[model samples]
Target: MGTMEAPILTVNNLNKQFGSGCDQCSNPADRRLDKNYCPACGTVYSCQNITFDLHPGEVLGIVGESGSGKSTLMRCLYFDQEVTSGEAYLGPYKEGRSNLFRESSQQKRYIRNHLMGKVYQNPVLGLRMNFSSIGNIAEKMIAAGNRNVAAMEARGSELLERVHIPVYRMKEAPKNFSGGMQQRVQIAKALSNHPPILLLDEVTTGLDLSVQANVLDLIKHLQRELSISILLVSHDLGVIRMLANRTMVMLDGRVVEQGLTDQILEDPHHAYTQQLVHSLL
Candidate 1:
């Protein structure tokens, strides 16, 4: 919260589905097949309704058990999946203005290029295990229109050092690093350009408690230093409590409860929240 900035991303009433039976494709191989609705259930709300905002310099945590659509929501935001309805006004959706319910391919592309960064739950999914951390980060910078090899490598080394990974290891293959270290490399890659919005999906899921704590501290430090907004998706209530300013509890693809982190943690209103909190205690 060091600087004044507008909301970087907004999503309203977003809906997504796998197969609800609204459209049919004669040839499944066609990538340009038109989709009006669900193809299996013929329903509009095939998945669920989701509404959220990612403001500058804030951390919003989305928490739920497996299959509750947490990952689906992240995928939709990142354009890995499509939204059936609702508005997603990202970097360029509304002529660079704010539009909560509008999905603009142009805006999505702009955000992907200049405003958004994402880290997957498994670092291997985002990081190339076969390449060194320097190579992994350098590839992203090059893809983002940074052509100076020396400059890119310098920046990559800086990023790795910022994330607490020694710059010397930047030349080692990512597979040689431990899970926590690999996750740090993935973070360095995500931070290559310092995007305004960072989407993290279960970043500490497979790590030990000690490693998780270290990673969490690193993220908090970066968030404070960079003044970037974060959207965290996780199934662990403890992690959410530790990191999030606000918490959104999802169930069956829908948000069940959302409020201040302490409010929801101390006095959960939803049964789902209660269940999650009790399990953690």
Candidate 2:
């Protein structure tokens, strides 16, 4: 994606916390804590001043170890978890004028259903285990106000096929599928609405190496075919290297580094980032 084009999505100063702040942690500039936690107040800062932009038809990867707030950031953007404070703008929503975080619940639901789709790390969170795979895809379409059963069925089968899930198995429930298949079904469901922006939160985290490669290849092909903008979250630098054009590195609830994927890999500036790259070597 070119830098001249406006970003498809923009996030500013996003923050999420698990507990109320005490006197010691009230002011961000003066707060003292263990990593992201405030010892005296027991408040955990899951995401702190997180900011980034996702360009059209671009894959922006967020990489960090566990507890680095990468997943929490995805949750906030997808509206699965509320942000403590932040502003997000979607280029296609209100001509990029509204702050998505401040929208009403009804509007937020509208955006979630129509403007974006998310594939969670866990299939259970994204799909109904007991429902047929196609039914799960239809559920998302229904949320977006689709009423024609025939159209949904056709679309569901098309998507599942695109993800390499056999058309014959579309009637099966996700619980009966293998871990990789479950994730593929989740991807199909997320793409049901043909959303412009996709939030992928560690979609290949628990799969075998071969399965992970298969899923990643599917994502790469689909992204190019559909020209969909993706925000991909993972702890694996290798995954980021394969799929991301730009990369953001998070640490201790904050963004420690970000740049072109190649530049960061070759000349990492942060100490933590250096360690991560060294491990890859």
Candidate 3:
């Protein structure tokens, strides 16, 4: 086997805040310090001092409870939401690196267009729910400048095939598919651009155990075949143990422990990590 290369994405001190936006009022309806959205004050700080690196061919799992800022961090990294402060470094070389927090529109667009791909917790949110599966995937390809219908269609077909979605269902709207199929379709769409790094934000949430296992296996197969680095966020320990190379445990807006998956699972250092592990059992 060849030696594995290093990470393509690194995050340092990442932070995001809502309600503080000039657009929101002083007496905001929602506010919380650790919660992505504040309940009392309407101020949301996704978290502070959050950091991690995603290596090629590696699956990094981020685990925390519901209010632990996992989704907010995902949004910031994937560009769905703004970064309040700090840096998200992409790629290895300084020349190729970018700070998601401060990059210009053109720069951000370029990075998003070329390197980023994301799968949301809810597949419908990530997908063009109104379009056929093929149209949804192809729309992303076309927007990224693929205009040859024959090639686009062929590629789209291959994508669906790779995700185990039958070509006959290509014209059906995602609404017709089960939650699992929708997740698979969303994966196909994310891979349409051949992104180097794929971020999955709670992709298996709310699914039945069997379906969740299938989706997890599918993602592992894709990662192996495509050599794409993955950053997976979840509250499930079983999922992390099965799929991740490294795991990061978070609590009250801080990373309490991070290490190889097996190590963290078997022997966690922090009290919060211990509690999380015990709870999982």
What candidate 3 gets wrong by more than 4 Å, as runs, is 1-5, 19-42, 92-94
TM-score to native of every candidate shown: 0.86, 0.99, 0.89
Lowest summed lDDT window (length 10), candidate 1:
25-34
Q: Mind giving the per-residue lDDT tens digits that candidate 1 earns over 138-185?
A: 887876788999998889989999998886778999899999999999
TM-score of 3: 0.89
**Model 2: per-residue lDDT, tens digit, 1-281?**
57999999999999999999999987999989899999998999999999888999999999999999999999999898999999999999999999999999999999999989899899999999999999999999999999999999999999999988898999999999999999999999999998999889999999999999999999999999999999999999989999999999999999999999999999999999999999999
Q: Per model, how many backbone clashes are there? A: 12, 0, 7
Model 3 clash pairs are 30-38, 30-42, 31-38, 31-39, 31-42, 32-38, 32-39
For residue 276, what is the lDDT in candidate 3?
A: 80
Give all candidate RMSDs, comma-separated.
6.1, 0.7, 4.3
Model 2 residue 53 CA deviation in Å: 1.0
Q: Which candidate is the best by TM-score?
A: 2
Model 3 over residues 175-243: C-alpha lDDT tens digits?
Answer: 999999999999999898889888998999899889998999999999988888899999999889888
Write the candidate numbers in order of decreasing TM-score.
Answer: 2, 3, 1
Cα error of candidate 1 at position 7, Å: 2.5
